[model samples]
Target: MVSIIFVDESFRSGRVCWIKDIVVAVTAENMEAMRSIIQRYRHKRISLAEAGATRHRSIFNGLKALAEDQPDVVIIHDAVRPFVEEDILLRVVTAAKEHGAAGAIRPLVSTVISPSADGCLEHSLDRAKHRASEMPQAFLFDVIYKAYQQCSDYDFEFGTECLQLALKYSHTKAKLVEGPPDLWKVTYKRDLLAARSVIKEKISQEICVVMNTKDEESAGHLLKEVLKKELNCVNVTSTVLDHTGGNVQKFPTDQCYSFICVNVVSSEFQETQKFLSTLEESGLPLLYPVVVVLVHCCDLTLAPLASKMESLMWIRSLAEDMKKRNVLLSGLLLNYSKDEQKLQESFQQGASIIAALVKERSSALAGQLLLA
Candidate 1:
């Protein structure tokens, strides 16, 4: 029997700003397929069109419905749990199938305190005895749903936990496992930087730049070739498009995401400024919140960054403009480094700036569809 995974969260449903009402639901025969779906998107020819099994309702009724339609097993997780690795998911599902219930947990990082009668003295629980519950909670579908069905309006209106609900009525004990620190929920502004850092680390080592640069009147083709040799894991592909006027012939539906550039090259700083200034006035492509960047530096000397910040200042300033549009943007100066290895590293790093930016916003939004 296939297991269903429920990744619940309120993401910026249509507009990429306020995350008020949204939930993504999906099901896979096993955990490996669930992970491959994420890794496969590195190429530009993947599809993330899975049908969601169940949808979360506003308030607490969402869980109530999951309990109504009992299945083999239901795994409720947080979409904000981007750091959730596949192995962690495998362990929980397997355990739930065997023991009827399982959940991921971790040691608390903060003290647990409650207020006293008159703001004087309260009690605090020993942190060692308490566990901070993370997500990917799994259970035999029937066992959990029945518990919800038996719940009163009080339970249905205010319940914030699945494990506690299972424990209260089904009398099931959840087998808890430690989770990685990155599994921390993204609830504040600081977390955006942390999320970007994680993506940067992942792209530094393994990346493939497959492109069709046959019709370029410029140096994008040459950049791709040299970039392949410099970065250890970076792969490059540049072939002629078959009557298609695009770098990537197919829209990646699964593993990889795409970031397309729509800017031309110029030498004079004023001309470059004029080119980018038009982006602010033009909203043709700015309709989407994710910002887009146009790189102008194809040839510049790489002298330890500090020696040449003026020529690159245009790119930095442009990145700021793109930020307002919600797209993180930047420019790269393709220049010779005195150290041959260092020059190559510079080129590879430039390519990664674009690749990694694409991966972060390609989350598949699950809706309407139900589980098997």
Candidate 2:
């Protein structure tokens, strides 16, 4: 129910048209960037505001824009730093509520030096004693509003820091929360690429279920029911591969980026293997990072060591090949049970694994074996 106001600004150069295109793609079919997200997700509590010419002016305008709404706290974050996490947001908001002001900080990665008029370094400051102030700074609504109102025009036009404004006007010492390195801002073309990649990982929600089980009807029905309830705004489809594997043609392989291969046992990986081939032939991985999950439902008590080893070898081989093309491959061995109680537990666990794979978006899990 928390509200977010995404501040927008004009880029100085036309070379960065891609940034505008990315924003347009993300906020299409809605009012503004923040409003689009709020409406798409049916979040009634959030709102948006047009940014001002300068950073200080934008924050001041944002606070004034939300004044009538009477938000308990207002968070001012830079749009360039897109890696801000929800936990860090919570920490800042909580601290702001308690201390009137709070901000994220990281250890200075480089030494700070004072330069003389001749542009030579005069002295160096101890890096250990200093910290870099980062975005996602929060303040009690009244505190920031009053600070902005009492500020001088020179400070408003030239100041780059918000913590200093709060300290100068309201005498509020901001609580500093240690933040991770991913909070780094996007300042160059390479940084923009990294930011876009992070955004893709967070926003990708479509998942495909490749059913290779003998009881395709039952397996597909159970997975659909669980996924529909567990994942939010997820587009899930089940593809049933016939004995000849030609039925795979019916799958909308290009529409979905994540795939889950469901099989009754390790040896039945042929169908899943076939689907992986289909993916490679389509060349989707080269355009976007693809995630492939192999879920093997088996009665481990009845499975022999030889079959398990064979499956592991196959998984490893496929994973190695796919990794080269930006396709992440992971496997889960689930103990199948017919009893209603055990079966329910397994279904939940399996659904969780699929959800985690799609959400994490990291290749570290590739070639890893998981027990569900």
Candidate 3:
């Protein structure tokens, strides 16, 4: 599939002239994977040299190679504006592919004036006619590469503008897009504060892991403990359909299903026993079939949990909960870890289990899992 090319240029320009570095990074090929990696380490600053490539040549070459072989829609951007939104990228690239040239621009804040001798301004142009060209400039591979292919060192080194290059050589008139306020470049120290604020707002929305907890003798602390190290897992007292909206995106399913429960806590596990009991007593709609994993740790001796109280304390408790006929158990898991990677496996196991159950009982995997 043709994907958007994320272009990031790091240059010590404008007021911050003390730094001496001009880097152009082009991320393409398996765009989603690259993006996921970026989001995973958003706070971390990654350098091209660490990836085994030193210069901007390697970065540009990597992008060019991917472009020639893959032939995908490319969106070139500047690292000065680190707070670029995905919507703007999508809009610009989508238009660029259709029109051959598309670039984002903002209103000129200061008047462009020319100074002759002293520190006095001589001439100034109408700010209305001119606009401050910003990042997130997008163009098709053939259109952009062609411009770079037939260019000089000035165009590659001193000439840092992407949109101007495309227009200067290819005679391609760029579709100047009015960018959002967040598109402002991080030129001065004040711009960095603005960037930080924008980034903070972007991450304010929490990623919630909603699970059902009906344990009577449990305070819902241990489960939260395991998840606290990885994610924000909130255990709902029951399946409350009234709780809607907020980041409530779900997988395709017809029924209302919430919660990931582990029924096979050893007999001594009060949380497991009471949770099953509470689930049986709670009267809720089974909008979607739920995912339940029967888990028991192998490393730690869980024989005390399973055999100390009774041979079938955990199994009978789940069976009793099943009698409620509220929701269906979709999947089963024997063991799991609190590790981040292991958490994904557990989620997948539960998702697959719910997918099968939904398919068997209802519309089947129609809206089972929620998108992050």
Those runs of model 2 whose alpha carbons end farther than 4 Å from true positions after fitting are 1-3, 9-46, 199-209, 212-256, 260-372
Candidate 3 deviation (Cα RMSD): 17.0
Best prediction by lDDT: 2
Clashes of each: 17, 0, 24
Whole-model lDDT per candidate: 0.50, 0.71, 0.48
TM-score of 1: 0.51
Which candidate wins on TM-score? 2
- Per-candidate TM-scores read 0.51, 0.54, 0.46
Q: Candidate 2, overall lDDT? A: 0.71
Lowest lDDT sum, 10 consecutive residues, model 1, at 363-372
Better of 1 and 2 by TM-score: 2
lDDT of 1 by residue, 259-350 (tens): 33322333334543443344334432343333233433333443444434453455555555555544444444444445657656655665
- RMSD in Å for all candidates: 12.9, 12.3, 17.0
Q: Order the candidate numbers by TM-score, best to worst.
A: 2, 1, 3
Q: Model 2, 125: alpha-carbon shift in Å?
A: 0.8
**Residue 347, candidate 1: how far off, in angstroms?**
7.8
- Report the Cα lDDT for candidate 3: 0.48
